[model samples]
Target: MTLFGTTLDAEQIAALLSLLALLVFWLVVLRRERGYARWFKQWEADRKARREAEQAAEKRGASPDGRKGPWG
Candidate 1:
């Protein structure tokens, strides 16, 4: 709150404010991810792609990356 020797030094006050800002930043990120925003949507798409790839590899008797597994 005070820049010069006000109970808490400038550095301590700045650190406290910075931590608060970081907390707000994480809260916003969590809200966006939970809301299925574009960023979260990208993750969903990636998961779907992995599922499809695994299914295809299974049919071909291989791993998800197209390499033959031990059973194959």
Candidate 2:
């Protein structure tokens, strides 16, 4: 309050309130952005697929001795 030896007027107070409202609106829109949601789904799917492949490999008695499994 003493930085410039002056006090804020009514217009300055109103401007601050307007800026706060705009900030909240943009934050909401950013939360609904599709690209962010899509990437999360893609990452989850990839993780699931990898787990399934590993489980299938384990079920076939496949060895890590560089030999192909019977499924091939």
Candidate 3:
């Protein structure tokens, strides 16, 4: 009953392909962003640790209780 019978619809195939492409693109972008975010968080933590260490060092050389330091 059909002339040159084709079972698939052209519009449906195109739409499916477009959706697949978008899914792949977003996956790649999200993976890269996640890696960068982890790196940034680690960097911030290291910086804070270093600052706290410096402050501790400064305090150690400071006066004991209410007494002045020897170098003061």
Candidate 4:
């Protein structure tokens, strides 16, 4: 087959296209996985902050839900 004036056998063309498609597929998958990892990291940080806040509130004799305790 003639592609961009370069002659390639049918099998070679098919192989090249298949490899190109595989490369694109892996790129997309890696992008999505990276995004997921970033999101998860943010989620984990938020969760940690919330836990710390709860612990601090507990030490202050206040309920973690922002309600006053019996003493207050």
Best model number under lDDT:
4
lDDT of each: 0.83, 0.82, 0.85, 0.92
Per-residue lDDT of model 3, residues 1-72, tens digit only: 222585547776777789999999999999999999999999999999999999999889877774675755
Model 3, residue pairs in steric clash: none
TM-score of 4: 0.76
Q: Which stretches of candidate 1 lie over 4 Å from their true place?
A: 1-6, 37-72
Whole-model alpha-carbon lDDT for candidate 2: 0.82
Runs in model 4 deviating more than 4 A are: 2-6, 62-72
Name the 10 consecutive residues with the lowest summed lDDT in model 4: 62-71
Candidate 1's TM-score reads 0.43
Q: Write candidate 2's Cα lDDT for 1-72 as tens digits.
A: 322777878888788789999999899888778768989999999999999999998867766674785754
Measured against the true structure, the TM-scores of the candidates, in listed sequence, are 0.43, 0.44, 0.66, 0.76
Candidate 3, residue 39: Cα displacement in angstroms equals: 1.1
TM-score of predicted structure 3: 0.66
TM-score of 2: 0.44
- Expressed as tens digits, the lDDT of each residue in 1-72 for candidate 4 is 888999999899899999999999999999999999999999999999999999887779855676675755
Please rank every candidate by lDDT, starting with the best: 4, 3, 1, 2
- RMSD in order of candidates: 10.2, 7.0, 5.5, 5.8
Candidate 2 vs candidate 3, lDDT winner: 3
